[model samples]
Target: MDFREYQRRARETDQTPDTDGDGLIVPLLGMAGEVGTLLADYKKRLRDRDTYRLFKESIAEELGDILWYVANLATKLDLDLDDIAAFNLRKTRERWLHVGEKQGRLPFYLLFDEQFPPEEQLPRKFSVKFSQEKQGSGATVVLTWDGQTIGNRLTDNAYVDDGYRFHDVFHLSYAALLGWSPVTRKLMQRKRKSNPKVDEVEDGGRAGVTEEGISAYVFSYAKDHSFLRNVGALDYELLRTIKRLTASFEVNIRSPADWERAILAGYQVWRKMRESEGGTVHLDLVNRTIAYSSE
Candidate 1:
């Protein structure tokens, strides 16, 4: 079905009456939880080599639930899922294809130690981290014991010399939605010039604009849309917080040592906010080839 159809079904499933004691945050958070769960399940099936049709179907079903709730939340807030989707597609295009001198793209470094050798072996812990001190922020990823890190391959010529980071778009989008000053945009423009491939560039594609162009446009358009004013106003704090976090993460992409410190600190903050409820912790930074564990 189309985007609106997905949203309509989502609202039918997740939303309650205007006075049924349900608000926006509850369902959004629920959706986030389900997405995490679905991801976990998908990994399990992949590790077990249980890639049967039924397993795939089950994973897809759970993913649908996640998407439904996400749509419901967006609809409730008068947000456009299509717009978000479009923007995200553009960002992905830029990051994977257009950004920087391809060589600047982050390097992939997979590990296959005896403890967490491969999917065939009993799982220990596997993680991937991507960071850039030049961009000022980084991420630390932690995997479950059943996870394996493999095939850190680069198929594109663009990921060669320098390091590139694209998360500033999060802050830029958030800032635009709130009618914040254009400082973020100016910064982004500078960042794009310096790293060429990360920022949205004009191109033609399936739709009128290239998918990335649409993302860049929606980011500006959504802010100007009158119906979104209320929703944007309400989400001001969340956006602002995201912008700050993005800025904080992007500040450490300079050197490996610097990236390591910045990424760990950011990961700690992220764990506190996003994954603190869970017990197991394993964050591995690929470029640095270091793993941090907490039990």
Candidate 2:
């Protein structure tokens, strides 16, 4: 049955039918109790594995019971199950698919430098050669493009090696996915110099440092989560913090999924870069992708 019809019929069965006050407590307790039962059933399935022939039937039964409790709770809370379900699905799609996302000529689709010369625009497609060299007790990365060093050599700067030297891939991912990266623009001499205001505010030092801060912040968070290895999604708060950090900048307009994809793509390339010590990072803004190749 449809959620609305099912909800109405289900309400008829609520032991603690919605009353003027506090009568919803029984359904709340029942819902919590059903969750425990669901977990116990799942544990049984995991423990028994292939031999648990009744696992499917039991899981379906438990889930049905839980759904009834959920509908009961929703009714007691004066909410519609269908409306809640629809709202949640829309939010999930927007976060996962980045609904209304678009692509354009300039990074982040901002027209700040669309009229600028090629030399002053972030290269839509290019490769940055990566090489690791020993420096003091720790190793550092030397990034070069067309045989010349680009950015200052980078290192983890921490007591241990966590591959932060290769963090530039994240910036490259931003350039590719969002068409925005102050760090990448500076490193490639792609700063929009035609307009002094744009140069100072959009492609200037503070923006570059802010981009670096974004990288470092996400790195610390990802480190605690195994560098986001096998992670399918990012924490909503993390994405929100990233937006807040960039709120004063042009990239503040990017969606959560945009940031999520960029972060994950960077880590995907990062794993390969870390394995090979260093590798060439490829950026393609048209297709919005960043990839790695061993040098």
Candidate 3:
């Protein structure tokens, strides 16, 4: 049966009244409670091997309860279950299929359709440099990219002794792909004044963090592809640090191959948003420049 038809029939069984704004609340609570019951059943199955006999049946029943609450909630929100399902599938397909096909290819080739240029063919080497200055009881760390000062962080003796560093070149590549550079951010800010909602749907709500996460994924891919080595010897901590920092974002970074797939996935997401919402930023790695456009 069609999902809409199922939703219609399901709505018929929703006897909850609209009184006291409890219609949504009822289903929301039901969903939470049903999920808890489902978890409990799984826990029991894990604890008791004999429970495996009934686990499938129990799971099916709990899932049905969860579906009922979901349908009810959709009804309360005036949303169609079929529409939600369709939208989710469309989003996933758009963001994965094309990019997934490009796995195993060099990132520059996958992203810009150009071969990975030899080091001598490139204009200049990319590097993130750091300097330290002694303060009262500590030192302030200053970071620079291509001789342009970028950021500063105050650090204690121990922190400086640790020789920690931040990698920005990989992130620059990601920012170039997603148009999340300082210039892009400024443009977005200006656009927000005229159309506040533009920023809401574009850039995934947190462009900086999103770029960092994608960049980390690409860094992993680059490392395995030998792109990092091609450029120069890199600090072993670069990928480790990026992975640690972006872990909070819940990005999947299982293996080198997975990271390449993830980069494509991330590119598709930002590309779709840009195509629909109207903004463009292209990175010219050779010239080390970013060109921006907006509609």
Worst 10 residues of 3 by lDDT: 111-120
lDDT per model vs. reference = 0.38, 0.84, 0.49
Ten-residue segment with the worst summed lDDT in candidate 1?
202-211
Query: For each candidate, what TM-score against the reference?
Result: 0.32, 0.68, 0.45
Candidates, ranked, lDDT: 2, 3, 1
Using TM-score as the yardstick, the better of models 2 and 3 is: 2
Top TM-score: which candidate number? 2
Question: What is the alpha-carbon lDDT of model 2 when measured against the actual structure?
Answer: 0.84
RMSD of each: 21.8, 5.6, 13.8
Task: Give the C-alpha miss distance for residue 136 in model 2, angstroms.
Answer: 3.9
Give per-residue CA lDDT, model 2, range 60-153, as digits (tens).
Answer: 8878888987888888789999999998886576467654445433233553346788779877778998899988788989999988899888
Q: Show model 3 residue runs off by greater than 4 Å.
A: 17-20, 87-180, 183-295
